[model samples]
Target: MNAGEEPGVVAMDVESTHMPTNSEEFVDAPNFDLETYISRYEGFSKIQRLQYIARRCPRLKNDAYRLAIKDLKEGCNTASYKEIMATVGDSLGPGYGYDAAWCEAEDRKAAAARERLELELNQFKTNLIKESIRMGYHELGRHHAARGDLAAAFKCFVRTRDYCTTGRHSAE
Candidate 1:
């Protein structure tokens, strides 16, 4: 920078969140005394202050602080301050920063569990078909056939055929 150039108007790259100055940047704080609280923890990093406030005064730990602390930590320009504030604030039941990503991850786990259960059920049904046929339980095969499950009856017939040829059950 030139000697006569203004300090505040220094040319910056497109990726700067905070100014390269010693002064702390100011942001709007509604519904709380955020500025004074910031000054109280002026020497602390935004993350540190948030941790302290969350531990000491959870009632006073508002959304604004969470957003600022997250912004300081992540350094991504994806979310507006208010959007971040609402996400950090509105999450309930317990704990901190239960954002969209966390919820989506949980949903994925539940879906996977459901899929596994379905697979286990199908395998159990296949085993039952094989067992009923091997035991000469024609009534169970006839019941399945009456239910319009020809595919299951065919599976049972195939098992019976194999058992007759090999002289051993499919389970063996």
Candidate 2:
């Protein structure tokens, strides 16, 4: 009923004449001051306070909202909204924490880069040994072999092998 009208008369805002059936479905009146509106329900029941904030804020997954629910579940008031926001950076929406496939993809990318680097190193070593023998620097070639140059050590053992291939090296 209206505050000062007749007994059966009901109060209704200009835009919405049909009152909300469910308190959770209630939209805030136009130009409502949110903080003041929440404060008004503090002395009311917990369900009413929760409903008011839930309907008013409309950001259910926010860290501040989650902290408020936690506090409410623990039989305490929200205490401080800013403190709740400070404690949690991002709110986890209704799902598991990390993605296993994403981690695996990142690991595969790193492995591919490492493999490409190793292949390039092997190709460089093969080029160096061929050029050294071609220029007839045999001792310097042996020095390279001692330095763990893979191409010089494994592929350039020409004293043990048959005569060198013509185009590969003229080290006869």
What candidate 2 gets wrong by more than 4 Å, as runs, is: 1-91, 94-96, 129-172
- Taking every candidate in turn, the Cα RMSD to the unseen true structure, in Å, is 23.7, 29.7
Tens-digit lDDT track for model 2 on 7-102? 877666788666676554534344545454444443214334544455455553243255344433333222233233344434545532233454
lDDT of 1 by residue, 1-172 (tens): 7787787886757785655766543433345665566655432255456544544555654643554545433432222333444645655334345356644554465456445644654565577655434544333344334333457546645555543434454433
TM-score of model 2 vs. true structure: 0.21
lDDT of each: 0.48, 0.43
The per-candidate count of clashes, in order, stands at 0, 0
Q: What are the runs in model 1 whose C-alpha is more than 4 Å off?
A: 1-32, 39-44, 69-97, 100-172
